[model samples]
Target: MDNIAGTKSSLVWAVNIAVVVLVLLWTIPTFGLLVSSFRDRDQIATTGWWSSLFPHEASLRFRIGDAETQRQEGEVFVIDGSVFEAGGTVSAFGTSNRDPAAHEPGEVVDFGDGISGTVNEDGSYRVTSPVAFEGRSPRLFVTSVTPPRFTLENYDRVLFAQGLGRAFLNTMTVTIPATVIPILVAAFAAYALAWMEFPGRSLLIASVVGLLVVPLQLALIPLLQLHNAIGIGKDYLGIWLAHSAFGLPLAIYLLRNYMVGLPREIIESARVDGATDFQIFLKIILPLSFPALASFAIFQFLWTWNDLLIATVFLGNTQDQLVMTGVLRELLGSRGGDWEILAASAFVSISVPLVVFFAMQKYLVRGLLAGSVK
Candidate 1:
């Protein structure tokens, strides 16, 4: 008994460790992206998101005031300025671009011909020459330790300048109707398959099961052609139909299997009360099937919201009609190196589906488990 107890304790430790590891794996990256979305472009480029939480050393280069602004101090020409515009402690400065941090701050370096320069810790700089200054101002490179910085500018630019807000509305326009049409149609079909006696019922169910394994890519071109032929060419309506058609098979299968599991006595009792088939479905099956309906609704909502290929094929990529996913893809291509924009856009695109999933998670879990057991 002692040995068995030891083995159980070891198993529990292993399971706890595995759960912690899995949670970290998912949480770390998502947390980093969220942090990154709020950071400025320079901070994001210069340091990792993990470093954004702390003060870090950074460097920048700036030019001294132009010769036009130089003042004469007796025999010496003088130029005065600050390395940092908003003020920062300067750790180092350099005259040459090739080695900007070659000299430590507050150290003077002679540029020959009676020309010398020095930068203080407060980023104030002085350049002195025996003769008048000429041409453009000489450049200086300064390194400093910057405090942790955060901003909402990335979100502002993406939502306003990049038109992500419009794309979000467009995605909603496609997703809502696509999700609803399939559920309504599938519920009716599922009820018939589950409770009504019909010819080829088994064959129809088997066909739907087979369709679940079929690749959606195979249908894209053919469906596009068919839609065009039917005069629906490349519109929200066309994409809605395409999503409905693609989503229907799985929706019907899940809802029908779930409906099949409902207690037969309830359905039979209602039938004995002279209730019509439609009334039985409306009153009895619909309420009991909430879990299943919610499960399918979440599935369809996520699928339609995240879909790219179907939207691309059936809907044109105009600014007025492009979905959030399409806008994100465009950002990936156009702003390939802009991590702040990309991360902010990605977080925005996924926010709605996350909310929907969490809101209906209980029903979704119940539907899936109940359907499987029954």
Candidate 2:
């Protein structure tokens, strides 16, 4: 009964649970990255994104008032001021680095010879000495608990100082043409294979499938040499052609599969009406194949947009031509230790792909129609 039609399988529940788990697995890191992008380096280093909403305790070193800030109060020279100029609560403090939290706030430490210092919970500090203060005031290490803070400075620095703005436009330049040209060319090829009779059609389809498994790394150097020979050396045109070539096989395979699945009656009736192949394709086939086209568009857009190797090989890595991935690679090398900047740059790079995916996701499953119909 469990295997019968209109009955549920025991594994269905397990599959649903697995899918929810997978979605959360992917979403959690992305959410963390978004949170981290808005934070400064210090907070990110000290705490995780989940802790960003609460106060964070950190041990910090601050210099007390220097000799110039000291004033004579009766017979005693005194230095009085808050260690934090803006905000922070001192929970504990010490005058030596070895025991930074040796004393609680509001407790005084007597250093002998009539020298004493005290720090209060409100970050205020006072030091009194019988002798005049000298250069280089005392170093105070305090444990402070600060309220949560967020900022847009990370985005500002990444988009402007890191050159991501220019790289963004360059990636758009490469990806848009790379995606469209392949889809247009593959649409024609797919229509011919699906409907129009032609010699060697089976061989061509077989070749397309064969190319799908072939790794692109095998052709990078050879393709670069070919680009140079054709006088298209190291330009957007060359990279566009490279992406289109690599993407075409999959594009044609998918569109052909979906086009072949369309009801045969429509094509036969169009042919009987004296319609040419181009007319059948433009008027009849293209409109019906929108799901497949959109599906391929999403794939090619994401692949070309995220591509680093092809862009590096065909488009020279000049600042004028660097893509988003290359610019991010440069950032990773130069600012590898700055997690905030890296998080911001990474989020910016994936923003467009996320939008494109969600926008066309409905068509994605519809286009995977291979062998669905006899």
Off by over 4 Å in 2: 1-24, 45-53, 61-63, 73-76, 92-121, 128-131, 134-141, 368-374
What's each prediction's TM-score? 0.83, 0.84
TM-score of 1: 0.83
Q: List the residue pairs that clash in candidate 1.
A: none
Q: What overall lDDT goes with each candidate model? A: 0.88, 0.89
User: What digit string (tens of lDDT, one per residue) describes model 2 on residues 152-228?
Assistant: 99999989988888899999999989999999899999999998887999999999989987998999999889989
Tens digit per residue, CA lDDT, model 1, 210-275: 987799889989998998999998998899888998999889989998899899999999899999
Candidate 1, lDDT over the whole model = 0.88
lDDT of 1 at 362: 86
* Candidate 1: stretches off by over 4 Å: 1-18, 60-63, 72-78, 91-141, 367-374
Model 2: pairs clashing at backbone N, Cα or C within 3 Å: none
